[model samples]
Target chain A: MVSLKQLDLTDLSVRQVNEYLHGELLEERPAGVEILNPDGLHSIAAGLDTEVEIDILGHAGYFIAGMNQRARVTIHGNVGWSVAENMMSGVVRVKGHASECAGASGHGGLLVIEGDASSRCGISLKGTEIVVGGSVGHFSAFMAQAGTLVVCGDAGPNLGDSLYEATIYVRGSIHSFGADAQEEEMQADDFEKVAELLSRAEMNYDAREFKRVSSARSLYHWNADAHQEY
Target chain B: MCGIVGLLARRSDYRDDLGKLVTPMLDCMATRGPDSAGLALFRSPLETTSRRFALYAANIEYDWQSLADRCQRELDTQASLTFVENHAALVSPVAVNTFKAWLKKTAPEVHLLSVGQSIEIYKDEGHPEEIARRFHFSEMAGTHAVGHTRMATESAVSPAHAHPFTAGEDFCLVHNGSLSNPYSVRRKLESLGIAFETDNDTEAGCRFLEWRMREGDTLETAIEVAQAELDGFYTFLMATADKMVLVRDAFACKPAVVAETDDYVAVSSEFRSLAHLPDIKHAHVYEPAPEQIYSWSV
Candidate 1:
């Protein structure tokens, strides 16, 4: 039998709920937790380190499920900025659209946005697999050092700017690429990676239809004639 | 970070509830901005021969009836005043120039907020909820409204520095970010014989656009020109008597979320501020892309 705990934001403040999620819940380890009346407030289920299945019922504000570890969190409505930022491990899924910087700077995790993500999505991504069912806005994957970002829809301008190690697969049109980020021929591994992420996100797109983007490695070298070099 | 909001009612029934609808939107954005708040509401137009002027005075006990009498006695202009606290809405058949001159010579301390057939402006330095309550913002009925809650980054915290800054007749703009070259914009406009009321950065942008419109550019063209001339981060929500225009800068660092439905179009700096609108869950909510023009009719 699964024991479920529902926390109403109107009845309990976000801090008290977070303290509950952070402390006693770890010992009880309830199988499921539901957060009601998000009401576009900030930091609803942020900084969780649990294995419980958490669900958010309404629209949430900034940093909805940031810094997650081992929790399967789902937001049923749209989320504000930087959902699931800096996650070491977990599955954070937003059923609706996301604002800016979704899954930003996550060292590890599978973050999925079912709707369009705004500018700078996955910015500074260290190692997070982000599968977006819809389009992504400008400067997505900026300075991403590791991980894979799969965009099933169009990518906005400056996609994968200053990228490092991380790979991007966009199924639709790319407005433009940023400095040092370039579209490379998709290898077999790229197709496999996209296929795996799409299946995990429960999206239905042909992995072969995707294009890959990665760093050019031009800015990594030090030239004597370039003057200010280390 | 300041917050900006605008609502245009396409449905006739919604017009009567515009204030009741938008008051919570403004008050909800108080988290983003707590220093001051202002609103510009557009009602059904008066006669073409008549005009409306929104007046603001520092003295809460200022005599608006005496000012109307003075307009009759001095400038031979018939004016009616509807007042609450330090703000008053003055409706008259007076020529704007004649009324402005008369005001300058008579009560120099009173600030003229806007002039048009439909627009009425109210603003003050305080929390948005208090400002709304003081002016009875929830009781106002209008076709559309533009409002601002100012955190006052680059300017003082006076009521004058608060937003929904007005320019020419029936035009006003609220800003959510700072400009980098306001002094230069001010210098150029001053050379063109345009005067400014405050050193606020948003005032510079407002006057520049108004001056361009006066020089025969359409609002769209003036905004296009402003995109090049004005440099900085901004999500500008502008309104005329008939139109509400929203635009973000090239970088678009300042946030703007727009929700449009069959009944109305709403714009705000954040979705939290817009979450209270009727049937907002069904509205087409989306972030405005960078450097794009979105205009809606009242």
Candidate 2:
């Protein structure tokens, strides 16, 4: 049986909570942790290196669980901007909507948003797999280098602008696709991959409705012949 | 970067604590904007059928009594004045335009912060908490209020450049994000005889709305027209005597969240700002769609 440690952020300052989470907790390596009454505090549980299970009871502010190496974090309420930003490994889940720049520039991780995410989700994602259950705001996956972004709902405008290499799956309507981003037919392998991602995120959604988007590869090298496309 | 917050109470019981509640919301977004702060409050109109103007002077010790006396003598009507810090609230039975003309001729240096039946605006170049303290915000009681904390990007930092720019009578606007083509817009409006106070981009947007409203367009129509005319990323919170409106650009780059309950409608740049509101845990919170105007009327 795993022991559970409890922490409350009602009175502690954001700096104090971040310091404790990044310093002592990383060294002690608690099996499970619960943060009660988060109340929209910022930078909570950021830069965690331990493989521990953590749960936040209330709303969290910006950069919650950012730069995680190995940690399974679950936020029971909504989150502010840049949740799970630049994660290396492990899973971060939000039961409610997440604000802008969620999972931005993450190299490796699984980010699951149970509700809608605001603008700039999964921007510059590298090897991270993000699953959003609801609609995403504009400028999502802008300049993404690599990885996969799966949206179960509608996607906002300018999706995947200036992409190098990334696989995007959307089950609903897309407002507009960004430059160099084109819709591709979802193959049998693509469906299997999306099914695995949804199963990993613990979300129940029909995989057949998903559409695949990838880079057109037209802007890979500048050519005067393709000037009209540019 | 800038932070904006607006709160309108549907119930009169929450009026007394409006300032106290909104001040904290403004203070929480201090990191987004640290240079200057401003607020516009709408209190219940006085029992008398008089128009009110809130005036601010750079020198805190400027004599406001003489101005009131001048207005009373020249306009042939009773004028009442009340002082709070460097601001004075004056009420007169004269029309707003006539009173404003008289004021411009008499006290050219005294700035009119706002002129309306119930609106009072106070702003200065400083931290939000300092500005709130200087204005004694805790003692104010109102039905609705809007505030802005500005981090100057294109304009110089001063009280005049601070936000909550008045458009017409009781209409004011607070903006986050920059306008791409304000100079061209300013030139067009200037050609139409719309006088401008500051070179700030937000002023151009406000004056555009004022011009549209003057041309018989409703606030909703003006906003829709603005969407087609204005370029750049912006989230605007506008307030009239009876309504509060919120609009975001089509790109939706700048953040805005709204929480509504049976008693109040609250808007802020982030959820952290609205976390402390009464009954927020059960409040219906959602982000407004891009380019869609969300409004509430009293």
Highest-scoring model, DockQ? 1
- Residues B101-161, model 2: lDDT tens digits: 8888989988988888888899888898888888887677898999999999999998989
DockQ of each: 0.70, 0.66
The CAPRI classification for model 2 reads as medium
Note each model's CA RMSD in angstroms.
1.9, 1.7
Off by over 4 Å in 2: A225-230, B46-49
Off by over 4 Å in 1: A222-230
**Distance from true location, Cα of B166 in model 2, Å:** 0.2
lDDT of 1: 0.92
Worst ten in a row by lDDT for model 1 chain B: B72-81
| Inter-residue clash pairs, candidate 2 | none
Please provide, for model 1 over A46-76, each residue's C-alpha lDDT reduced to its tens digit, 9 standing for 90 to 100. Answer: 9998788999998888998899999999999
**What lDDT score goes with residue B52 in model 2?**
80
